[model samples]
Target: MARQKDAFYFDGFRRSADYACQAAKLLSEVMHDFNPDQLRERMDGMHALEKAADGVRHAMMDELVTAFITPFDREDIDELGRVLDDVTDSIEGVLNRMYYDNVTDM
Candidate 1:
């Protein structure tokens, strides 16, 4: 199951990092396998990771809005959350394009 929404800023980042790692690993496996038929399935899995990362980011923003005392500036927190999610989103993007563009091989 998906991880619980981050309760703290550090948790959000750690969750995002985990999602990014999962995406990277999934993408690596896809490339190593080099199967066109499986591209769609791979894309689906990548998207799930990206979506999970997004959830943590969104939760982080929600917390930031209500948090009065933070370790850093609001902008920094928001930026970090965005950057963290981007790692997974970026990996998903690669798979997305490959699937849509009908890429037959690596």
Candidate 2:
């Protein structure tokens, strides 16, 4: 069946938040384990989550560029997207530091 476009207003933002949650959850998993032996493997998995989040952010931006009427101010939406991206990036950064510094213990 045909769908309605305006039926969903904050879908992009919701998806971005979902991505942030996923990244945070994975970060928690890696921190809890603190397994240096499998650090590379865990980082690889984190990279996948980061990339998926990036994809969602990029798609949202592209949609924003062509949207006629957003639920809120466009700048606000953009800023929110950036902030959420930073959150996921920061979570990934923690993993990166742990892997780089050989920190295996809590």
lDDT of each prediction vs. the true structure?
0.84, 0.80
> Model 2, range 1-106, lDDT digits (tens) per residue?
2235433436766777787898889888877876788889988988888888788788878877898877678898789888888888888898899889888688
Residue range with the least summed lDDT across 10 consecutive positions in model 1 = 1-10
Candidate 1: count the clashes. 0
What TM-score number comes out for model 1? 0.90
Report the Cα RMSD per candidate: 4.9, 3.0
TM-score of each prediction: 0.90, 0.86
lDDT of 1 by residue, 1-106 (tens): 3223334787878989999999999989998888998888788788788888888899888888987777777899899999998888888998888888988967
**Segments of candidate 1 deviating more than 4 angstroms:** 1-7
